[model samples]
Target: MTTTQDFPAMSGSLQEPAPFWRRRTGTVVTSAALVAALFGGVTGGVVGALNASGGGVAAVSSPVALNASSTSDVSTIAAKVLPSVVQVNVRSGQGEGLGSGVVLTPDGRILTNNHVVAGAQQVTVTLSDGRTVDAAVLGADASSDLAVVQASGVSGLTPAKFGDSDRVKIGDQVVAIGSPEGLQGTVTSGIVSALDRTVTVPGTSTGRRDSSVSYQAIQTDASINPGNSGGPLVNAAGEVVGINSAIYSPASDGGQAGSVGIGFAIPSDQVQQIVNRLS
Candidate 1:
């Protein structure tokens, strides 16, 4: 489930927003049946049976240790943002999807990719501390492939600070945090590779996985995978700059093709615009 791999897979044009659905880098399981569900109901009884295993914001001032040129700032950024990030596992009657999300409110608002929870009858969200909570879809937009969910029993949490994507520059150091292939709390470091690039991806919320949506994106070399969808891409200062939404892959099945260091995220400015409309 690591994004450190830098190799080319099948040659061709690039496809966007496909879940890092391949074999999971030998760690993530795409099928909800095989992956370890952290909660009951849609996530299976695993979490319920165990009563859940154990386990956000500046309540966020920036971590002072961050050094853009030192290379060690990746951890500082991850530590500041991971608390707001979560692992999302969803199940519908016929199928399921696994992805990551970020907490937006102390009272349980969550933001994630539409493809991850689309049509899901059941959704289980695992917090950074390992506690799992059931969630319900509140709103979804297939056109942008973004969605929001509401979780029960949460309050007074730290929210992620949104950054101005228009200010993001090429080669800026960044960090991506997500549960790639169901592996929670995974962090990858890289630089913004491109910005304002248009990407077209199939719609997962409508069940028409073959359909496509076009939107401007923030491209980064940070390691993002199939399960990394909807996760946050934070800057050196720990403010979320974009939502990791898609990646450039060449596989036809889409699932078989893996990341080649090129990944795309929905910029925070656009994300905030959409969230404002939905919320």
Candidate 2:
């Protein structure tokens, strides 16, 4: 019955969209049964139930920019970005849920998915150096599925360098970092499989059942899982091009969901736009 994990898919449009089957993360069962749906104006297939699943601009200062042409190796990228990634844990009367986040400022401003902290009463974040600190939600926008949390009395934290997602192209190398299944600081690599993908998920700004949050997501082959939500999907240059969000997992016999190479991230530009407001 935890709320942070499930992210049921919704339908929308793209200039030239293609049909693709999609689903949410986690195995936690909710009240509803699984149902089929379309994504991006194409009759893809059924979108799964909620598993129960950053930015830029003038409002926030930028991190040191890495040389995009210098390297795209996983180790180098992970080394540069790891310090900014964190494991986010939330607790409510209903229960607890886990996700991830990216540090936005040295003073401890963080960027994460709105669903990760939705309905959360207490929130804490584990930094890359194994420090768990208390945090307070500064703002949350369900329509964009983005949020910002500020850690108490923390300073000198490394903020992630964000790249321009609009410049990302298919076949570009990318790396995803997050805490999957509570495993903090895990790193995975893949390519930009597609772009301008319209993905709709089950929550919205109005908190209405009929309304959904539709966003243009960056499609990738990176192995994203449940706890990976809100993590950084970085480019080879060690700059975050997107925020790792959801994955499209086919239903298995046990009804458990895992990454099947089809993962989606909220474009960094959109993340910047939303986070600039949230932070």
Q: Which candidate is the best by TM-score?
A: 1
Question: What tens-digit string does per-residue lDDT give for candidate 1 at 73-134?
Answer: 66667778888888777765444556788889988788887766766778888888888888
lDDT of 2 at 187: 76
lDDT of each: 0.60, 0.60
What are the per-residue Cα lDDT tens digits for candidate 2 across 143-243? 77788999988999999888888888777876677776566777777777778765555552321222456667777776665567777877767788887
Lowest summed lDDT over 10 consecutive residues: which window, candidate 2? Answer: 54-63
Task: List TM-score per model, in order.
Answer: 0.76, 0.75
lDDT of 2 at 183: 69
Question: Which residue runs of candidate 1 sit more than 4 Å off their true CA positions?
Answer: 1-10, 16-67, 251-255
